[model samples]
Target: MAPMNIFDNTETAFQLKSDSELERAYFLFKMISMEPLVKIGSAVTKFALNVNLPVEGLIRSTVFDHFCGGVNERDCMGTVDRLHDVGVSSVLDFSVEGKEEDAQFDATANKVIELTLLSKNMEAMPFCVFKPTGFGRFKIYQKITENQALTENDKEEWKSIESRYDKVSKTAHASGIRLLIDAEESWMQDAADELCEKMMEKYNVDRPIVFNTLQCYRWDRLEYLKKLHQRAKAKGYKLGFKIVRGAYMEKENDRAIEKGYKSPICESKKATDDNFNEVLAYILNNLDDIELFIGTHNEYSSYLAMELMEQKGISKSDDRVWFGQLFGMSDHISFNLGAIGYNVAKYIPFGPVKDVMPYLIRRAEENTSVAGQTSRELTLLKKEKQRRKL
Candidate 1:
């Protein structure tokens, strides 16, 4: 057996994937590393979809297959089994987006509840995750966040959303499965934050069954974490915080420019990384009252988390702390950490190919924007490929 450090490269991580698959991954990352190509490809793909072109097969073979779990909950089981065989768990995330209708929202909520129930007995499937906007309108969320008064009909609609949040959370608590609420854009985050806080207060009264995600790239999340910690301290509830550097940086900055307000994003990547590590240190220091999930692809951040755990005398297997990378992007980190008996899992985003095209595009954009992400993934794949003599 290897030592307990997360830095070691485990050849076993890619044992199940074939040489052809490895080459395909290398090609994909090579394509994504070209920022101009990504921009043009995203535009062309969207245009093709708009004209109802036959693109599903093309997408399914490339980014979708590489990144997603499967098309649906049942479809993801085989993947769950494979990860479990390697001692890594799955945090299943449903990736359908652009939903705003009442019926659509209700169905999404049901799917989330169903996933939580499914996780109840499955050791491989450890957690369920969903976005709040999947259950309610974005406009309503914005209005609520801005403290705008709602008409009677809108109030009733908001009540319906609250009921849906309760159902998913209560089901997670009942099933003994933890849930993560994904972070979204800044304009409507207040509503999402408030709803997540409410659910955490209720479901986390005993244990951390519900987790609130924080985007540390926002420049405000360090203080936000502090405020939540104080509230958890005063209200006698555990704070379940999953911190990420963030998505939606371009969107957030664009909207801020359009609205003539200062951007909510950090001025630089270093600021975000520094604040993320600072908040991570605080979470580790206050492990008595917080269950943390460090959802990041940054290897240095992962190493920093492991270092913090060691300094605090927290075991590598500590359940309260977890390191997460997306399902396809960081097999090196995920498998190495899992191989060493550290608490870790892949973030498995799943949905139909067409319904998930937006997510795929965002993933591509994130890779190109996150400075060397694609290069890093490509380097790791090439290293593994060379070792296997592929």
Candidate 2:
């Protein structure tokens, strides 16, 4: 293989100095590099106007434009076409979050179903992702997970949750679009897992129509993956698993410490990386029985997966194995993987601007948390700026 620097290939192409687009990226990096500033700004804004303000313009100019398809399904069509032009596809993930009402849940479910239906006609969209919390109350999920007896009202709410999922699953199945249930915080995860398993049994019979995300940073998740695989095998159905390093390590650890319980997170980053690679190997080894989605921003992990495919004699274009990155974080990985003819798709998120504030805040915090992320972005912008000067 020829020597390749993916970042150089990706970042150097767009001139940073003369490019207005590149300057906007510099501004975003500066904003997200300080967590205290982001938090204080968010608090002030929320206090001043009892609503999530429009942060989309800042996001759109930098992260969203680079990573997301667009603000809505209609807006994302151009993104879909562009990715398809390069042999990649898109997965629609509605970015709205933090809903507590049954009516809101029902509406969110309906929107997902509509998106799935729309995806049926669009060749570029192969998968649709949803969060159970988007349609179910968190406290209700907590109660069920804790084995609390449900009151009549709670039972009615649970029924609505079931119906909402059913609507999404049925639409996705009918439309031939896959559904990926995103993992949530550890406290609320048991219920989400139960719900996902139920959905899998119903919709994943003939094929793996629904996937449950497994965060490998959780110490128990590798074993969970194995157990899930065993269940799928015994049931004589295919299993779909989306493996990720995780999104909420800090929160999970802090809560565990506060409650005086054993932390569910891996003890170290190495441990998480090991578990992630092991799960990747296991899925690839059992390729016929499991469909795998490798979701990460780590370049080596992505490369290792490709290497594993070569070792196992699996084609790089295998439909069962996919490479996914969040909508706004890793264009270098996504675009280069797409360039190499791999089965790649971005997790495209969209909603009205205010409803997506939580998602945006997390994105900012994550970039800041990952050491060197902002600096790396700054370096790339600076390098590209200097290159333009040449």
Candidate 3:
């Protein structure tokens, strides 16, 4: 069995954080643990930003600095280098959201391509990620997912979206960098999944340069993965997947109820955990054909992956396996894993302060909602504080 409490080493976990920074993290998690404060603060922040209130500085100093790398690729290098010093790599995530225009989509695509080029020689950053909606409108994906008839303009729009994806994927392949395509709402995910597979067929010829996400909250994901694996095998291409526990459970359930359809989400959190572990085991078992990026902060999942890898005699530094966590969260897992020679990366989110508020707010709300996430963070922070005697 893998060692228990391997993640409890506060010294290694917070080795990079200064006394002040540790206190700030503790305070931030404390604030996030209060569900009511997060709701009220999210609303007020939105209002303040909309009315041109001078809250950007305040936001940047506290949550933004802690959670985000910076506003742009160049701005993020310091954080990137810092993490790399401790053996953890980074995935630069441009976290801006809610765009409905062609120009915005093109710009996002261009930024991703530019970032991929920038990372070509940088060992600190080996990966790039972008959301499906970042390259096109949500409605387009939903329409295609539902198999509804598209207007002529929709076809043109979708073609543009595909062009954007192709440009980014080609650049990533050429630069020898891996690209992660994030999953979104279930209504729109089918279209994204199909497009991602197409990219994998084109770019993942030698290895997995293009990876799609599997949100295991949905019970059907394991079956979907099995079918996709069969297709990839027949088509003669490698496959890569980033497995996540999903992010939109409440929205998924509420939408299902309103539409009078069965929810695609698993019925309980335990079921979701089971589904995630099952899929993880499946991909690990098929590492010959599929490379995996385990994107979770759950300690048990991390430990399980370690145990499974041990049982299979996989090297701790196997290039085909990676562990990932978001920046500013789960330092215990990220840093300790890196310290022990596991391949790990942090998803470093960055964007303009005002534009990335939605992402930041969602992070706060998610921390509040996920059971034990905030408390665990607080516990580690406290332990680190005591160790530092600060």
Error of 1 at 297 (Å): 0.5
Q: Give the candidates in order of lDDT, highest first.
A: 3, 1, 2
**Candidate 2 local lDDT, 1-390, one digit each (tens):** 322476465442332124776777677778788889878866764454354455557645665565455667888877678667766688887888899877888888988988888888887888888997998988888898878999999999988898888889888878888898899888888888988888888888888888999999998987888898898889877888899988898999999999999999999988998989998899999988889999988877887888888888888788899999876566667777777778988888877655665776677777878777678777767777666668
Stretch of 10 with least lDDT, candidate 2: 9-18
Task: Estimate the TM-score of every prediction.
Answer: 0.96, 0.92, 0.99
Per-residue lDDT of model 3, residues 1-390, tens digit only: 788888999999999999999999999999999999999999999999999999999999999999999888888998899899999999999998999999999999999998999899998888899999999999999999999999999999999999999999999999999999999999999999999999999999899999999999999999999999999999999999999999988899999999999999999999999999999999999999999999999999999999999999999999999999999999999999999999999999999999999999999999998999999999999998987886
Model with the higher lDDT, candidate 1 or 2:
1
What is candidate 1's lDDT per residue for 163-252, written digit by digit as tens? Answer: 999999999999998899999899899999998999999999888989999899999998988998899889999988889999999999
- Strongest candidate by TM-score: 3
Candidate 1 error regions (>4 Å): 1-10
Q: Assess each prediction's global lDDT (C-alpha) against the native.
A: 0.87, 0.80, 0.96
Sliding window of 10 residues with minimal summed lDDT for model 3: 381-390
* Candidate 2 segments whose C-alpha is farther than 4 A from its true place: 1-4, 11-18, 48-71
Error of 2 at 371 (Å): 1.9
